[model samples]
Target: MIYLAARAITTVFLLVGAAMADRTGEGGATIGSLSMRWDGQWYWVVATAGYPADLPLDATGHVTQNAWAFMPLYPVVARALSFLLGGQYPIAAIVVSLIAGYVACLALYHLLHARIDRVAALWAVALFAAGPLAALFQMGYAESLFLMWLFLALLALVRRRFGWLYLLIPLMGFTRPGVLAFALLLALYGIVRWRHRASDPLPARQIVHIVALGLLAVVVGFSWQWIAGIVTGDAGAYMKTELSWRRSWIGDDGGFVPFDGFVQASAIWFRVWGLPEPLGYVALALLVVAGAALLLFEPHVRRLGVEVRLWCASYALYLLLVFFPQSSIFRLLLPLAPLYGALALPRHPAWRWSMLGVGLALQWWWIDQMLVLGTTFTQIP
Candidate 1:
């Protein structure tokens, strides 16, 4: 009942937010138009126009953004659904996202309920709904689709259905490249369990089956890169295209920095707080380390089960590694919904209610900044 009520209320919030966002400077306002922004536009292009035979490049020989960077599954699904909606790809994509988002919510609720108390489970659902990028769940984006497969992967782990993981790997991979992080976490867990000879009811033959399935998961999770290589005839086609956007971000000193988001945040601290840059960076890094330690050592997180804890920990690291802080990180970090188990921890009633209030305000702030304040799609997440 809590899940159903939360789902209905979230749906209402999203539709109302979409309508408000739609009423921009332009006279025409539609849900599809509001939904199909930023990455949604690229997915829509792929669904309607398909990938380019040749990688598009600029005069400087840098790869220009193109459809090759996006995974194929969402667009493929959107294309098929378009037929039902008179070939309106944008509308079709929004429909797919809304349905997927609700289903993902259900999966999350079930997974939480099985592990945590009903109150915590309900709070986790509510936390996921009130998150800053919760609005993205309503948009024509793959976040919710990827999340559906992700929570299913969690459910599979809880059930100890190791073989089901193999299927979810590719399904999740084609939905979002972040599945690689998930595959790695699973493989690591399997390896540790095998080494410890953990209490398992499975026979030796089933152990072998589990190992083989893990290998397949890792391979299939990386299949998108191989497919891009085949299509563009460049071994690094996907990474190159995906990283092309970083050219603008990397500044004059060109190279990837691990935990670049932290570095960026440090810079923000220096500018905003007038702290010494070195001091600011160290302070930010320490804060991050402290937060990570709390999550890892917290009794609440440990109680969420080993698999869920490991998955959340691995994904948080993945975000630190690849996701430079931007408006997009709001959506990127939505995959960390499992960690909302923290919200389930016993806290003062005022503290819990205050956190939810803050989250909802931030959600509105993000939506308004992106939809109403920003002039271009590039400015929005």
Candidate 2:
């Protein structure tokens, strides 16, 4: 009920934003079009036209952005639903996202309920449903779907149900690009279980399952690259396609380097704004330390249990290793939605209401900036 009401409120915000954009001649008059903006359009292209056999290149023969950057599952599901909706991909995509968002909420609630009081768990769901990125629930993006799978996978891991992950991991891998974090989570989880074997029995069967699931995650994580390579006849097609976007932001710095994107991005962003590059490095180091301390020492976060903290650490490490901090960084952090439980630990009505108000305010600000007034390159959402 909270989730549905939150979506209803978000719908009102989107409608108002669309109207405002239309008034400004920014071209977001209709809800359908608003939902299909930004990367939503890319997903539509992937669904309708399919991936290119040959990589599209610019005048200098550098690979430009194309369908290869997007995963196939969400668009494919949307395409199938479009057929039942008389070929309306926008409506179909939104429906898929909405349903997935609802399921994600339920999965999140259960995931939290296992570790916290019922009221805190419910409050976490409310906050998540009305988060700054709540617009994602109704948009034509795959985040909600990926999040649904991710939450359920985490639930399975929490319950020590290894069988369900065989199916969920592949779904998560195809739904989005972050399943490598899940692979890392499995490794960290195994270590924790092994260390506590005296209290928590890590039987031989469970160890085999853990090893197998970890191997499965790694395979599925890189499976898209292999598939793209086979189809495009370029072994580096997927990586190159991903790098194209990063290059657009920070220029072609030769080849892809793990863990270098943030270092480069911090310097570039600070230099662009006329700040000292060393300050950016200092700020980045502080951010990393703060994040680590939050997971390791914060009381509310500690109450969320070891598994949740491990997942947070795993995903953070994965992002540090591969992701380039940019406008999309907030969206990428959606996978850490489980952490909302920590935020919801405050039982005071004042804090809860204040946070909700702030979340809605930020949601409106984000929608206005990214959807209404997004005419330039820097406004990419």
Candidate 3:
């Protein structure tokens, strides 16, 4: 019920934002159109046109932004759903996101309930459902669907249900670009279980399952690159397509370099805002330190259990390594939803309600900036 209400409230915000955008002469300002904005349009292209065998190139002979950067699962599912809706891909895409978002909420609640009290879990769901990026719940983005798979995968991991992961990991890997983090989590989890074997039982069968699952995740994570390479006859096709987006901001920083995105982004962003470049590096270091401390030392975060903490750590490291911090950073951080359980730990009504209120306010701000009035490159959601 709480989750439903939160979605309803976010829907109202989206509708109002759409109406406002319509008045401001924004192109394709209807609710359906707004839902399909930004990356939503890319997914639409993927669903309708399908990925090209030949990569699109610019005058400079560089890979231009194309559908290959997007994974196939969400749009493919939306395309199937569209057939049932008389070929209404937009409506089908939104429906897929809405349903997936609700299921993700349920999975999250259950995941948190096992580690914290029922009330805290509910509060966490409330916050997650009405979060600043909650708009993704109704939009035609793949995020909600990806989150659904991710939450369920985490639930399965927490309960020692390794068999479910055999199915979920592939779904997760195809749905989004974060399954490698899950692979890392499995490796860390196996080590932790091995170290605690004296007190907690670590069976040989479970060890085999963990090792196999880890290997599967790695294979699935890199499978898309191989698939793209095979189809395009260029092993670097997927990597080049992804780097094309970074080029728009950083102007072709050469080949893909792990962990260099953040460094380059930090300096670039700070310089854009009229700040010293050195401070950006210093700030990046501080941010990394702060994140590590929160995962290792924070008491409330500890209560969410090792699996959740490991996931948070793993996903954060993944982002630091591959992702360039930009406007979409908030959207990318949605996988860290489990950490909301820690924020909900404070039992004060004032604190909880205030958080919800602030979340809704930020949701409106995010929608207005990224969806309603945004027209420039920096406003990419």
User: Any residue pairs clashing in model 1, and if so which?
Assistant: none
Instruction: Write one digit per residue (lDDT tens) for candidate 2, span 1-381.
Output: 999899999999998998898889865387778789899999999999999999999988888889999999999999999999999999999999999999999999999999999998998998899989999999999999999999999999999999999999999999999999999899999999999999999999999999999999999999999999999999999999999988778777787889899999899899989999999999899999999999999999999988899999999999999888887788899899999999999899999888888888888888888877876657767
Q: Per-residue error at 207 for model 2, in Å?
A: 0.4
Instruction: Give the root-mean-square deviation of each candidate in angstroms.
Output: 3.0, 1.0, 0.9
For model 2, the superposed segments whose C-alpha errors exceed 4 Å read: none
Q: Taking the tens digit of each residue's C-alpha lDDT, what string does model 1 give over 1-381? A: 543454455456656656675565554555556667678889988888888878888887777778887888998998899899898888788778777877888888888887888777767777786666777776788988999999988888788777787788789988887876786677767765776675755468657756776677678767878888897798777766776765565533344567775687567647656777788778867967886786679888777877787787788777777665655766777888887776765666776677777777787777667754556634657
Choose 1 or 2, whichever is better by lDDT: 2
Comparing 2 and 3 by lDDT, which wins?
3
Q: Rank the candidates by TM-score, best first.
A: 3, 2, 1
Model 1 misplaced regions, further than 4 Å: 1-24, 195-203, 251-276, 347-352, 376-378
Give the per-residue lDDT of model 3 (tens digit) for 1-381: 887898889889888998899789875577787788889999999999999999999999999998889999999999999999999999999999999999999999999999999999999999999999999999999999999999999999999999999999999999999999999999999999999999999999999999999999999999999999999998999999999998879887789889999999999999999999999999999999999999999999999999999999999999999999999999999999999999999999999999999999999999999989877768888
In model 3, the worst 10-residue window by lDDT is: 26-35
How much is the lDDT of residue 263 in candidate 2?
95
